[model samples]
Target chain A: MSGSRLSRRTFQRLAAGTALAAPFVRGAHAAGKISIGFWDHWVPGANKATTDLCNEWAAKEKVEVQIDYITSQGNKNRLTIAAEAQARAGHDIMAMPSWEPHDKAKLMEPLDDLMEPLIKANGAVNPTVEYLGKADGHWLVVPATAGSQIKGPCSRIDLLKEHAGVDIQALYPAGSPPKADAWTMDAYLKAAQACHKAGFPFGVGVGGTPDSVDTAGAIFSAFGAVLVDAKGNITVKSDTVRQALDYYKQLMAVLPPDVPAWDDASNNKWLISGKGAAIMNPPSAWAVAKRDAPKIAEQLWTHGAPIGPKGRFAPFVPYFWGVWNFGRNKSAAKSLLLHLSQASAAEKMVAASGGYDLPAFEKLTLFKTWVEEGPPKGTLYHYPNPYNHQVLSMAGAPAPPKIAVQIYTQAIMTKMAVRHFQGEAMEKTLAWAASELEGFMRT
Target chain B: MADIAVSRAGTVNGAGGRTSLHRLMQRKSTVAFLMALPLITVIVLLVVYPAIYSLHLATLNKSMERFVGFGNFTFLFGRETFWLVVKQSCIFAITAVVFKALIGFVVAHFVHNIPSKGQRKWRGMLLVPWVIPPAMSTLAWLWLFDPSYSAFNWILALFGIDPVPWTGDAYWARFSVILVNIWIGAPFFMIMYLAALKSVPEQLYEAAAIDGATWWQRIWYVTLPMMRNIIAITTLFSLIVTFANFDIVRVLTAGGPLDHTHVFATWAFRVGIEGGDIPLGASVSLFMVPILAVAAWFILRDITKRGNEA
Candidate 1:
């Protein structure tokens, strides 16, 4: 062999070394590419906060980042998630809604390593987030600060005092712990009836939409009504369930006759139009009111939910950021998620959302943004459960996720209340719910 | 000599046939097939393939792992909500298509009677509903029927009438969705019927008048027979579209107010897409096929019979 040409043995060794190094070379080249799909925030300018943070991280890391803000309107984001999961292709990091992290856990890259240190820094993760974000004892996603919300009562201060005679401010004063002992479900019902007679109904929906489902879930949780227990057993025939249904029947009577048909947007429209005294929602309604109806916005107060016989349960839905196992740039995706999960980044996100986004971490909930945001100063102080007086919950919880997701999506609880409200006997309604629960378990 | 001549003719005929067969690419049928290749490919990829895939999906479990044959179907059959969807879907399609046909027939006749110069203007104006996308138009209708800030309720209140729960009550919600469908679809029917009306020879109407037949009698006897085929074909087409509708019901009620307003399409979407049960959703959607197929078969049969008679 010529000196310029390698001997056969040497050539074979060189070829094997090059082949071994090829993956690292490819990794170096591909490390720059990362894409993410975040939930499009309802609050104006919220998307900019997320974009700026991602860009800042991208510049520091010298990685190319592409971000797409997917909307929940018409379930487009959900459809996108389903499409990507089936195709095993899409953005490296995609936002998963409350139930979705559980639904698509098998396809997700395990994130226990990323989540553990963050949990240490940020404080304990809420049970709702832990329940939904973990699967088979592994963290499937990083809790996202965008699109998480607490569906607490946002009431018209003037209307509640004038008609309902409920001093909501005293019960949940700004910059103080909630004195909500007197704010029971019975008092809530009386206020609803009073507001209805005054021609401005409470605007609580009993329809099969997220807003209605969330509200119903909170109410049921407060009453200790578990239609399906955690063990995957049917418990719709319990007394607590009946008590919750009875309460809903009365509450529905005082609400608008069309509450049964209301969608998630209806309550926002109701509160913003000055047609409702209160609605169980996040601060988005108030944010819109501040823009379009300043007077209504000024009168709005975000407060804790009413205490039930069992306890105070606030409806909380958290969004999660999950990296796909099939992603080409998993390392970059994980790094960006970790950066976003830091306290400063999460605080900026919460502020940008106008206090509408609730961080899932216990320590992060005390961000001053929630304390200072308002036409009425400290209007949102109670919005984040500052004193931790209430138990944060996701509707259809405690039951195994498989059955719980079906219950939530099908709006079974709301439908049951509506059925009984529309004149079905309580026993019949319970029977119907039991039958539906049975079917859910079977599926 | 005669036998030899016959043999040579036969050979010539056979050779000519073989030459034609060899030049298949130049044949008219082959050219037509080539021209239609793109459309055929699209249909197979977009429609036929997804449809077959959905059938296969329906047989699998929720995870899309193990096959469960007819378990999804049997499960659906036992649910009350499934029965409710079946009932609502049938009612929605039949009622909306019937009303649309009646309104379209009347409006088209009225437009047909207008002066020829003005007919174009009226036709153009009437098609505005059909021209707007259903999703956009339904949004407008949703605002009009909104529970709190309804424009219609505002106007109704001016007359001392109470607000109508357009989509609040189960009955009203069903009525409201069907009404919107009729509003958007009646225009297409009007255009179709108008075209069919123009094709009906004026001589027949003139001949019926000479025989002392009244306007009503002429329409019943002459016009009905002339337009039967067009009406049948248009109705079948509308039936298929109406039965498979997703936008109107989804936007308006979303199978809400205790699932009283759920049709198969919306229910399938709730189960399949939002509910994360792909197999169940596939099963729910597959139910539409049999109803649509039977409708198509009956309408096509009637049209064929009418053609034979003609």
Candidate 2:
């Protein structure tokens, strides 16, 4: 009985298991702090400055705010995929793209649970039904700050006036900015052609992606063409397709020798370096040049995307922040969403980060002088953009386009336009492209 | 004696005789299997279960909550995007493997020709591309393809040649990507082939040369014939990796300048993960199975046949 009192091995096994399991159990329940996940160092308004601000907010609230930062550097495509995986695995609260929130409805929490008052406050949510809140009838997302806008006729006003012999102030007058609204594909071709003839042969950027496609799409959509229905259906051919092709071929002849080889950040770099004039880009172009390249930045002028033939129109890409669906702390997630989405926070973060031109939230205030201060001084003030209620409504329309519009657009981009630029089927391509997209839409 | 017998009986009967299952489990193998129980449980929980679950997902509609039963597969057959993806995956896989194998073999032979000490030195330095993690290496690839700031263009400029649209044009983008894959992959084949080359008895080459074989004939008769197994194995491994290459295409072009460069994996992820068409994504991912299986079957058959012949 004395010898068999207790087995030493059994006691050792029990003690070892207890030691390992105790910490894990303790870790699950002991969290009194909140983690705010953000795109680290990738974009401004949500970087180290934002991190410091979150810390400041936490200190004021007497709570701990742990920020888990990630960089979107080379993993842009994987961002959406990773988010879905994280959601299934669980995201306490992560910031993501506007379109992503709509796609990843299942993994996020409704902001209604976070701060119900903000949504219903003065009926702001009602007026901006598709504008500010949930798209799929689920309150899974909230517009954190002002929308992100680009498609600027970001130009060297000094260069355009200097090289092309155009007046900077008059073309863009006191209140109404010229070349700001959508114009015909022909108008765009003429504008570029006129610039080229004036001795800026390699005038516009055409690395064939962001610069080329943006300009091309601006023409395509402005002509009231739809490439894909909003529901993700493919449409190939349209009249808009033909018109865009005809115009691009005309425009391509005057583009620089290395136009095909231009990189994504090239036009921005060229515009900032003062090597080129009148590159269309996002508002960040103004912001970045203002900070890094002051001379070019000072020469910077911003404009909304040029209006298309169907009246002033451009693809309006909406940007914002939202609460991920499944979070550990529900109330805290909503409160954070409300606080961050506040006009105050957006402006502060924008000022802190300093590259954004448009705040998705309407409340942000950055007038002509916002770009004139400090490093962002005189450089960003050269351009003024006015996107009003009318412009907003058109860009924000909810309905998907009809079928005929889709087909024509596809033929233009995929078959004709791309092929034309490559010198494969230059002559016959435009007519075929026009009829194809239009025919496809009708079918 | 009776008390001793009773205690001994208790030792055998106390826990073991409780049930037939318990009685059967009383052995060294049973204890060994019992120890592996947690791992087996984890394999079922994480790997086996998800595989079964993914098959279930593939048979459903968009949301995956509703059952459609092979509807997704049937739908995929008619979709143009699905066929394009299938063609793209094959071209990507077949082309990458052949190039990697050919380039690797040539490099391996060159590396083998050096003195043993020189061979050791070159092998270590040559593996720099393969040794560095792929993610780190891909950044360099991205910079090379950068539209304006391309290092490739910078070099091309030095020679007074026009810069190619390495990533802008659809064909050029595919070319740029496959070239990068070759640069990173060839060394792996080189290393494997070199090891196989060294493993070949010097006597075989000597014997072949004695048989009046020239350099090309020696290589054909001695080198390739000797290194065939290594070549086959390496190509099969590369086939799986290159076919399922998501990182290079994703980071560099993202199936864009208009979806011309998309493979099955990236397209599936776009539809499934990004687009939230989970069932569609799952179904798309299933396209990789038959190709991967065919490559696997060829490798296994060769390996087993070698064993049997030996």
Q: Which candidate is the best by TM-score?
A: 1
Please tell me what DockQ candidate 1 reaches: 0.69
| Global fold similarity of model 2 (TM-score) | 0.77
Fraction of native Cα contacts kept in each candidate?
0.85, 0.15
User: For candidate 1, what is the TM-score?
Assistant: 0.93
Q: Model 2, DockQ value?
A: 0.11
lDDT tens per residue, model 2, B151-194: 98889999999887777777887887777788788899999998
Positional deviation of A255 in candidate 1, in angstroms? 1.7
**Of the candidates shown, which would achieve the greatest lDDT relative to the real structure?**
1
Q: How do the residues B106-141 of candidate 1 rate in per-residue lDDT, one tens digit apiece?
A: 999999999999999999999999999999999999
lDDT of 2 by residue, A345-434 (tens): 665666554545344433333454454443423333323233242233222123232232233122235345556776766446644444
**Every model's TM-score:** 0.93, 0.77
